[model samples]
Target: MSTGMPAYDESGDRSRRPTATNRTAAQVNTTALLDRLRTAGPQSLSALVQHTGLSTATVNRLVDRLIDEGLVLEAGRAAPTGGRPARLVGFNARARSVLALDIGSSKIAGAVTDLEARVVRRRRSAIVPGDDARPALYFFEALADLAASLVKDAATGPAPVRAVAVSVPGVVRRDTGRVEFAPSLQWYDLPLGALLEERLGLPVRVANDVNLLALAELRHGAARGRRDVLTIALGTGVGASLVLGGGLYAGSGGAAGEIGYTLLGRESLSTPWPGFGDLESRVGTAGMLARMRERTDALPDGFGPEDFLGLARSGDEAATAVLAEVVDDLSLTIGNAATLLNPELVVLGGGFGRAAADLLVPAVRRRLQGRIPLLPAITGAELEEAQLIGAAELAIDLAAAAPSPPT
Candidate 1:
């Protein structure tokens, strides 16, 4: 578990031992410098000092330290600056790799990404999650197998694997790394991060799928410019991720955006909703399809949510009516959320959500405009496999945060 960096040396100028506070500051400053180098590309010692706002002496020492750890490399000499060419140092994002997994109830999509979060290769496998009657061993073994296989495939030596990030369709405590529940997967109180770390010999970070998707969007998609945004996943189950003040806001219990559980209407105000919330129960994939089924028996067999949206788009009468109802439910839920949060943007995401976004966004916007005083601009999620991409980005951050490889 070397983190592909030299060992962290606490003893700087042994003559005067550094205090714990000083060591912490040094670590933070070093990370800041490395981040600057990673993002700004190659720079010479003097330029690094200017870019990082660190003293020339500090930048020189840190650069030399990173160079020793293989995290920094001499790209070449800089342009002649009235004197001898200065050596330019750059971050070596390829010095280490990461494994990012997007684990859905039916499938596990994995990829090996570089420290910069660029996908190197991808793989996926079908999954049948175990239930209460079944042991958890099967699920775990399958996951471990997928991680091992992904790492093996990418072990061609461009970079060494450093950490892992996983995306789960459930409630996960960000601080504890324990899964609270996954209705579809039937996984509860699962210590996914610890288990994976023990098995893979690397650090693991696990998060809810919707949150990760939001992270992906903010990092590399439509939420880029917005300071306050909501990323709602409209899939098998409804879930949302919140970004407030330019930061991923995981509430105290990591359930900040569980909007799916909101009460649907006055009729069910006191009714028991054990699993799927009223909003989700009414507007989720199953709910919309159920509406279609109730609409008519003349429709084609084996039709699904996607087909329902397609029919609605094509102006099928029954499907359009059903779509209207679905839109109403979604509009109510999204409008309420917008009224409360007043986010600058609302990003619709997930399989069903992304596909139906074209139809949903405008309708929701118009409804909210009349109902609420302020309305946020709504948009569909951009980027393929956004959850996985978010996982990759998290894995990269985990790797990057590792104590600058032990110089």
Candidate 2:
């Protein structure tokens, strides 16, 4: 997990001409300078040169470009000791903004954020289960409405909307940004990115919800400063994400960490339930509800996923038994992943995961102690809007990399 503050490498030859290579490298390195300002506030040009260890000429070139790009603005002067005051530069975070959305199975949530990926405004709409069964056009039209609403007020803000990034509950095609399959949403091969970009007249990035969540944890939450991690999301569904080499690893097909499909036993291998995977069927919300109904009928109907965890926390015998089973499944999954990826930490997130984290983290640690040779540090997510905020950060990156800033 990267905290998104990679070290500034001043290895470029100071005397190199501004060729295509130099321009490309400068564009990428410019972000490091801006990120520093984002975290450390304004600084003198001399200070930035000292901090980055780049030659004064190189820093001056980069700062001039950033000013032209509207990402940095002159912020008065710093006091000097008996010499001319140093010119200051600061990150202009509000000069540009992006929209982020998470279209989960249970609801749709979105936010508008500035360049630093801080949420300036947010909106969420609850979705009843099975609502996706409606016609795709109907569902999407409504979804687009909500997305538009998130940015409709952008005109009045300090920044202009530069781009939009969305996370969907599905396997997305890397090249096309198409939703290959989303069983929960009944969306298949949907050109979501292009459609939204066409509608909004802005750049759009679409990615897997879990992948975004993992990025969220890596950049803005509990897994910060870690280089490798496994973040599991236990909500209405069960899924996981991998952060390797301090970045997200979307496998060859953009489906690397689909742990929900893992088979726990030999019998599970023969089962052919494609909609919900084997591990997911056992540990997901439906699975817990099923186990509760099997063990005891004390709870009334219409009980939700969080209700089950809450009851278990209250020491209800049947709920506790079901929770123990969930913990066992999760421990097995985490132990196996740690053995392979050797992640430095493990993060538990999502609605159910967040709700049960206080109760689950300790039990999981005890369960994996002797089972796995190398145990990892376990923690809950620090951000409730991990997916949405992660998308904002990614959108900001995309905007910064564009040849020209948004009009």
Question: Across residues 1-407, which tens digit of lDDT does each residue of candidate 2 receive?
Answer: 11121211111111111223353666556765765687678988777777666678878998888888788899998877899988889988877888888887657888888888888888888766454456555556767888888778885777767778888888986556788888777788889888887788777878888778877776668877777788888877888888776667778888877888888888987789778888888888888898999998566868888678778879989999988998898888889899988999999998778778998899999999988888999998888778887788767766654545445
Q: Candidate 1: which stretches are off by over 4 Å?
A: 1-23, 43-53, 75-88, 129-132, 403-407
- TM-scores of all candidate predictions against the true structure: 0.87, 0.87
lDDT of 1 by residue, 100-123 (tens): 999887788999988777888888
Evaluated with lDDT, which candidate comes out highest? Answer: 1
C-alpha-based local distance difference test score of model 2: 0.77
Look at candidate 2 and give me any clashing residue pairs. 1-227
Question: Cα deviation of 55 in candidate 1 (Å)?
Answer: 4.0
